[model samples]
Structure formats: C-alpha cells, structure tokens
Target: MFSRLIRAALLAATPLSVSAAPVPANDAQRGLAALQAMDARVAAVGERLAVRGAPLCGDRQMRSGLLVHGLAQYAPAARADAAALFGLGDAPAVLAVVPGSGADRAGLQAGDAIIAVEGDDVATATAPQGAARFDAVQRVEDRIEAGLADGALSLTIRRDGRERAVRVTGDEGCASRFQMIPATRLNASAGPYVSVTSAIVEFVASDDELALVLAHELSHNILKHGARLDRQGTSRGLLRAFGKNPGRIRATEDEADRMALYLMARAGYDIAVAPAFWDRFGRRTGFGMFSDRTHSGRRDRMALAVREIALIRAQQARGEAPTPDFAGR
Candidate 1:
C-alpha cells in the first residue's frame, strides 16, 4: 500500500515531456556560427538606431502617478480576446491602476473587480471592440474634463465578495508602447524589436502574460546580447546584416529565452506561466522555423523555455529574493 501511494504521488508530480527530436549536433554548431555573424551585423544597425543618453525612465509628468510602459488601457470587453485565452470565463472583470497614478492614489488594486463605472453596468455593457475599450475610458475622461463630474468618477467594485464604491481621479503618465508583432521571419539583431508578419497584441492570455513577453524582450535590450554576439566573429556578422542568416538567430533566441525568464520573475509575473504560454504557442504553430530565415524551431524554442522555467523554480525553492520591479516610478 505504501509503495503504491508513493508511485502515485511521483506520477502526479511529473511534468509530461514534449515528444520531439533534438536538433543534430552539427546542425546546432552551424546554427550557432550563423547566429554569431548575424549578431555583429545587427549590432551595427542597432548602434545607429540607439538614442544616446536616453534616460531609462523618461520624464514622469502625468497627473496620475502611473507610468505606462509599452501598455495601453482598454475597456473590460476589449480585453475579451485575452480573457478567453486565459480561460477567465466569458466576461472577466479588469481594472487598471499605475503604481503612482491617480487610480493608485484613489485606492485601486491591480486585480480589483469593477462592478460599475460612472453608474453604468459594466457587466451588461456591450462587448467592446479592440479600439472601443480605450474609447470608453476616454469618454469617461472627457466627461470629467468638460467639468461634468464633481471631482471624482464613481466606481462600484466587488472585492473579496463585498461591494464598495470608490471615487477615482483621472491623471496621466507615460503611455505604454508595448506591442507584439508577428512576422514570417525577423532579424534577431534588430534590437528590442520583434517583428511579426501579422499579429495582434490582444491575443495574450493576461496582462501578466503580456508583461512577461515584454519583459523578456526588454531583457534582451538590458543584457546587450546583440553586442555580445558581435564580439563572437566576422562571417556571422555578414550573414546577419543581409538577413540571410539562420544559425545566429537561433543563438540570440536562446539567450533571450534565458534572459526573459529572469525578467518575468523580477517583474512579479508567475514564472511558471511563461512555459505554459510557449507550450500552447508551439502546439498552435508547430515545431520548426516559421520560414527559412527564422532560427530555433518550435520544438527547441519550447524546450529551452521549459528548461529556463525549471531553473527559476529551483531558485525559488532555494528562497531567493523575488524579482524587483523593473518598471520604474
């Protein structure tokens, strides 16, 4: 009986392995060499695009203490696409509050469940379109700006099952500019920009998931992987510059995977979710390059992401400090 119970417990704890063949050693080496060359060429291009002495945190002059970093506010219905992907049910409630923004000062939390906005029943409102979400919020703001409301907009919320009314003042901060671009192929050396042939930002599972993706991309920028690859050698640079390279792209992707894991954790997103996101993405997209110019097929990319997540879990088990907030005030 004891043995049977132990076996069951172990089986329950095991993560299922993805069935896919690893890239061949020779192929891997060639890919790595190609990646190095691409990195050098990309670095040259990035250097030209790099804005000198740009402050990490731009001027914070919003009435709301919130700083938008690569993100934009939308109505609850506009976020339906993401909500469906996350399995948050048909109509999940969403609320936005920047750390130092008016919403924060007015006492709003990230996960706050909003019941009503300015006496309108949010739950029953029409499902918002992509652009309509921002439009709705702007309408509320316009009312305030035109001196229609007293001082604060009335918001009814259900937190921990209890109903409460809160007043929120409108203020602004840096607009969040994060977006996901889909492309048949992209130059890894492009620096901080991921190209998508066709994609939509609203497809992400959650705001946290969106943040995780952006954080990972930002990690590449912070680590200077492009510059590091440039130091690797010459032939690699030539291929990457002309965008005919495949190997170097794979190497840069691997580095970005590792870096993204670190960045997401630090950004306070559930680190485990990152792997799950990639796994789903792989299933939908298939294993291999999107096109010949793309490197690191789906199988390899998914596997590497899983490995990184495991490393993060191990670090957490050792009682490491949580990732600090990289989004500055």
Candidate 2:
C-alpha cells in the first residue's frame, strides 16, 4: 500500500542444508523467513495493479501522476546461473516490473542488470554483498531513491552481454509511499505511506485478496483520507492515545471501500474476492458490522463492494470506463 519490494537475485555460495532429526527451533524461524520473502511477491502484484488502475480512474481529481519505473525487488548475484537469469554479468538484477509504467515505457526490462546509473557504476553505490543479498539491495535502493529527485534517471541495462542507457521520467502521485512491516496482524493502514503487516501477507488466500487489501490502503492514499482527517482537527492528544474519532474513521472507510473495488476492476483482478476477504477478516477478528466505531460491519462493507463492482461491470458493458466518484470523497 505504501511503497514496494525489490526482489533481487542472490548467489548462494553453497547450499545450506542439515539433517532432519532434532532440528533447532531457529530452523523453523529460518524456514518461515524464507517463505515470507518469497510470499511477498504479492506486494509487487498490488503495486503493478495500482500503478495501472488508480491513474486510469482518477484523471484530475486524483491525477494521472506518480510515474514509476515499476521495478520491484532486486539483489546482487555473482553466479553464472544468476547472471544468466537476470541478463547481467555479475550486476544488479530486477525481479519484477509493472506493465505500462514509466520504467516499462523506457524499455527498462525486468531482470536487466542495472550496471550503472547516470554513468556512475551502480555496484559502487551499493553495500558489499557479504552474507545476505538484502544488504546489497538496500544500498542500491538508497542510490536509486537519491536519483529520483532528478526528475529523469539514466539506467544502464545489461542484457545478453550488451548494455543500453535508458532514461526514465518520474511523476508524482499521492504523497503516500508504501512499506511492508514485520507483524502478523492481518491489516493495512495508510497515511504518508501504505503499511501492510507481514501477517496480512501470510493470511491472504490469493493474489486477488491481497490486491484488494492493498488497493484499499492505496485508496486511502489516493483520496488523501488521512490528511483530510488531520485537517478536520480530529484530536491529536489523548484521543490519539485512545482511538480515532469513530465517525470520521467510518466515513473514510466508506470511501476507501468504494474506490478500492474500482481499482481492482480496472487492474483486472477478480472483485469477487473482495467481499470474501472481509467476511473472513471480520470473523477472525471478531469484529461485527455496525459494532466497530472506526469501521463498518463486515456485512456492510462487503455488500457495498459487491454493489460497486456490479456498477463497474455495467459501465464496462456500456463501453464507458468507470471513474472514481470523488465528489464528496
């Protein structure tokens, strides 16, 4: 909801394996960690969907802004196998890219090793890839973000041993960014950025459900719901220590719910999963429809999603693209 992932490649110096009997508890933790890393692919799906859908729905009300290279998750690799897959000879490799995004338009193909940025060797910008690939990825991301302010960035892509310098433009969307936090809590929230818990990532049944959740938080970003609430003077004192204003929170939830489904529709995700997720989410949390002050009941949210999805389908049937109704929201 807030930002993204950089699925980079890594070269395992040697395969780490152990006997099955009497394994250490840390082994389970390590297994879970690896699963979490791979499972996070869902975040990229949400990003690509949002990149495509949100702008289409909101022309001026929202903006056709926020250009992205659409690359997600990257890592440094040295092995010939890694080099072959990433299309680089021991360089930074991309994991995924959003279709039709600024990066896509610039021909910044996924898996192309970004060997350099603006003539500066990208490898020099990143941290030493000692034991973990993430360390290297972090350095590259920092270098990449530093270049974002330049409005346009030159990336050196290596494919089949040939290098090409591609320049990509940048655009602004909502002020919100994205982050995936480490927690098992099956929920997401947004303000300056969309924050999705690791728990939510593990809990979702499919990419469709995950995208719906992401779109909901991304919707909060697009609508500027958080800033608007703060502007309304929803107390920042003990009220914050307690909980948010129920009325204000509920209103924002309504808007987020509506806009999220349309985003899913435009992104080509199955909106049918939206309501199902809420039904499962509410039941697991023991939160009732009309019972929570900050959110509508599960039944209410799901029903609304259903209605809007149908409306979206009808619009498409009529050969008209549905736009987010931001009149009051």
Candidate 3:
C-alpha cells in the first residue's frame, strides 16, 4: 500500500512533457489553414496599399542591412555576401558577422562588400539560395578547418566602392554561435545570449536604416541583458519555468532598446531614421491577421524605442563618449 501511495505521489510531482502527446494532424492543418487565410488577407491589403505607394503605417518592412553593416568590422565583404544571398549582387551591400568570432577580431567591419575570398573571385559566384550562402560560408570554413592552423585568411573587400585587401586571424576563444541580427526583434533572450531577427531589405530604402538596426542589436550584447535574464530565471524559479512571469522578458526588451539607441547614435547613424523606420510600421491592426508570434505590435514597441533614442541623443549631446559599434572589441 505504501509503495503504491509513493508511486502516486511521484507521478503527481512529475511535470507533463509537451511532446508526450503529439499534435494531431487536424490541429496542425487548422493552424496552417489559419496562416494561409491571414496571408491572403495581408496580400489583399498590400495590393490596395500598393496603389498609394505605401501602406497606412508607411512601410512595415524594416531595412536590416544598415544595422548589420554598422555592427560588422568588414562591412564591404558582409554586404557582398548579403547581396549575393539575396540576389542583389549587382547592388552595393554587406552582410553580418558573428560577434567575438574570427571575423570580429580581424577588424572585419559590417558594410564592407566582399569582392573576393582568399583571392578567389566572389563577385562571379551566382546569387545564393537560402542554404547556398551557408554552404559557401562552410566551404571557406572547411578550408580553415582543413589546414590553416595559423588561423589566418586573406579577404579582398570593397568599402564605399573602393577595393582593399585585409588579413583576418581566427580566435578560437570567441563564441561561434553569435549572429548579427536586426534591432527590430532584439528582445528575445535565449539563455546566455540574446536573439535578433533580420528584416528583408527592400530596394527602395538606403542602407543606413539597416545599420541602425544592427547597432541596436549590438547594444543589447554590450549591455549584458542576457546575464540579467539568467539571474531573473534563477530568482523566479517556477514562475519562469511555467512561463507565468513576463517581468524578465519585458525588462530585457526595454534594456535592449535603450542600449540599441546608444549604439546607433555612437555608430554615426542618423537617429531621426530610427524613429522614422518605426513610424512606418509602428501601428498594424487587423483581426485574423498575421499571428502575434511572428511580429510584435510595432507602435507600442516603437514608442518605447523612441523614448530610449531621445535619452541616448541627450546623453550624446552632453559629450559622453559613444559606445563602440563592434562587439568584443
């Protein structure tokens, strides 16, 4: 009797695994159908708005390349990669570099277009598909992995349409998983690291907007919001475990916004555009519209971001040395 009682208690104490029961096909289908419906609605709205040349909120799309360029050490090469991957190779651009990684230490800057890699002509390569860019990057990585024990590689880059060659030495101590992400979604905290999502770069906008986005994300890393989140997790315990407490989540976002504003201003970007970008997509409304999971309500978050930008501008005007744009420097 006692053994049976103990078994019951143990069972009661065990948490239910989310995967224990597989999601039903019907449920999955319903979710997909809902998404398709939303997509159709958005498309209709877009069609109507296209006539006006801009949506009600202006353009909801955030230009992310500017942010990536501001954060990257080798801006030219990164821009080339982004352009190549996004089928904009003919356009001048740069891609993002992982923070504290080899690229960061080698003085590689964002906004630098990679004209060549290790003397190989990169400009001739075909535009990359979603995974092709990764494959191309891996090929270079494989070369390093194969025999470049010296941890050095040569890169030919173009900055503001001027070509130059620079040598980058790898650092194993640097974290490998860090990514350059846009500032718009710079709120998600993933343990010791913060998560950033990129915006699709549109042809109509200048790259400066993209740089601002990157600057904002880099600020989040500089401020060390991830560590704070971890501490909050420990303190809150079960509340966090059950997702009942949103305090830490909200705090991290607020801190990131504040930090991003400082970083953008310091990077020599126009602060006015930061608010302008949000103003374009700040207020989006429609029922059965895009699910809340993919995007935050732009207006509410933009308001917070604007406040932070104002404070940062005030600080900069006071002559406080601006924060460095690069991470791990």
- Winning candidate number (lDDT): 2
**Stretches of model 1 off by over 4 angstroms after superposition:** 1-198, 230-244, 283-289, 322-329
Q: TM-score of model 3 relative to the true fold?
A: 0.40
The lDDT for every candidate, in the order shown, is: 0.39, 0.56, 0.37
lDDT of 2 by residue, 111-218 (tens): 466778667786443333443235455565555555655567677877657888887775433334444555545667765446677678778898788778878887
Query: Looking at candidate 3, what is the lDDT of residue 308?
Result: 66
Report each candidate's C-alpha RMSD, comma-separated, in the order given: 18.3, 8.3, 18.6
Instruction: Report how far residue 279 has shifted in candidate 1, in Å.
Output: 2.8
Q: How many angstroms is residue 116 displaced in model 2 relative to the true structure, after the best TM-score fit? A: 4.1
TM per candidate comes to: 0.40, 0.64, 0.40
Clashes of 3: 30
Query: lDDT order of candidates, best first?
Result: 2, 1, 3
- Tell me how candidate 3 scores on lDDT: 0.37
Clashes of each: 26, 15, 30
